[model samples]
Target: MLDATIASLSELGYSRTSTTEIVRRAGVSRGAQVHHYPTKAELVAAAITHLFHEQANDVANRLETMSDEELDTLDGIDLLWGALGGPTYRAALALAAASITDEELKPVVTKLLREFDETLVTNFGKYFNFNGEFESFWPIGLRFAFSTLSSAALYRELGLEDRAEEIVTVLKAMTSMTIKQMGKNSRQFGIQS
Candidate 1:
């Protein structure tokens, strides 16, 4: 049912995805949908949460299969970007836009988005270790990367698809330079691993 809701949101956008649509897509009874999710906001929230878990698991599995040499900030950004470009992310983006004017959904979406941000930070911390005080920057840096990539996706939706690679390339270069500076400062401050 949640998967059906995500599909509906991705295809129809937030305003048009009624419970009826989700039920039809899931091939489930309306009663079943109502039993699980009493409201559209609740249903969308559950769907986004489900997608978050799936994304986290996918990233973890990919990290587990990577060689040690492959574990770095740029590769991590690539992995994250891949997830961000998916249907689930598209669904979430649609809901995010609707949440702006939706009083009831605003809180729900806000809470879920905050949780997602924390999850991203935790996942990055588990898979990669920046040096010393630079480690403190991961949460901020990850959020910055997420915001930038998400904006890039919106730009793609607006028909600027050709600039996607350019945006990602510049993001990678900026991140790499920042990491290098952080490492230099860490070494200078005797904060070596």
Candidate 2:
């Protein structure tokens, strides 16, 4: 059912998603859904958590198969996009958008979002190591990279189709170049491996 919820939320958005739609898409009896989630907010929040956990596993599997050099290239952006720019993200984005007016959902979704951001940082550590404290610019740069890609996803979600690929391309280039420069700076300062 969570899968159906993710699909429903992604496609119809939070405002339009209904329990009936989820049950119909999931092909499950309404009884089963009610047994698990008595309310729409509960169901949607659980769906968001489920999708994020699935994304984490997908990212870990991809990281395991990718060579370090491949991970360091523009392909890294592709990997991140795979994790961040999909049905799950769209669903979560919808939830986030709805949260602004959904007092009942606001706290639950907000906590989940905070946890998701921390998870992203932890996931990055599995791929790369920094010798010491990050430069002040480091976190901001990383946020810029992710947010830029997220903005691209928003473009696609909003039907601004033409700019999506173009924005992603630019983000990939900017992130790759920034990573290279950071590596160079680290080596110059004897802070790298």
Candidate 3:
């Protein structure tokens, strides 16, 4: 059902994805969907949560197979883009936009997004070597990368696929340079770990 909901959201957008559509796609009875998710908000929240966890796990599994030399910042960004710049993330984006004015869904989406942020941070921390002194800056840098990648994904959805590719390539270069500069000037900037 969750998979069906994700497909529905990706293909139909959040506003157009109905319980009936999800039920039909899942080949499940309306009663089962109703029993699991009583409202659209609840159903979407569950689907987004499930998707987030799956993406995180996918990244982690990929990281496990990579050697340290293959786990540079650019590689990390690529991994993130691979995991998030796709249909599932598009579905989540629809839910995120809908949550803006949806009072009932706002809190749920907010909470799930925050948790997802933390999960990404944790996952990156496990593989990337953010020096102990610059640990506090890790999340800030990661959030910037995530925002840029997310915007690129949106641009792709808007039919600007080439521009999206350019944005991602530029983002990778910019992020790599910024991290190198930060490492070099951390002490000069008084940015203590």
Per-residue lDDT for 1-193 in model 2, tens only?
8999999998999989999999999999999999999888889989888876787677777877987556553565677766666678888788888999999889988787677666665665566553344545555555676778778888877788689889988886665566566555533222223
Candidate-wise lDDT, in order: 0.79, 0.75, 0.82
RMSD of each: 3.4, 3.6, 4.1
TM-score pick, better of 1 and 2: 1
Please give the ranking of all candidate structures by lDDT, highest first, separated by commas.
Answer: 3, 1, 2
Candidate 3 clashes: the total is 1
RMSD in Å for model 2: 3.6
**Top lDDT: which candidate number?**
3
TM-score of each: 0.89, 0.82, 0.89
Which 10 consecutive positions of candidate 3 have the poorest summed lDDT?
A: 184-193
Candidate 1 Cα RMSD after full superposition onto the native fold (Å)? 3.4
Question: Clashing pairs in model 1?
Answer: none
**Best of the two (2, 3) by lDDT:** 3
* Residue 107 in model 3: lDDT: 91
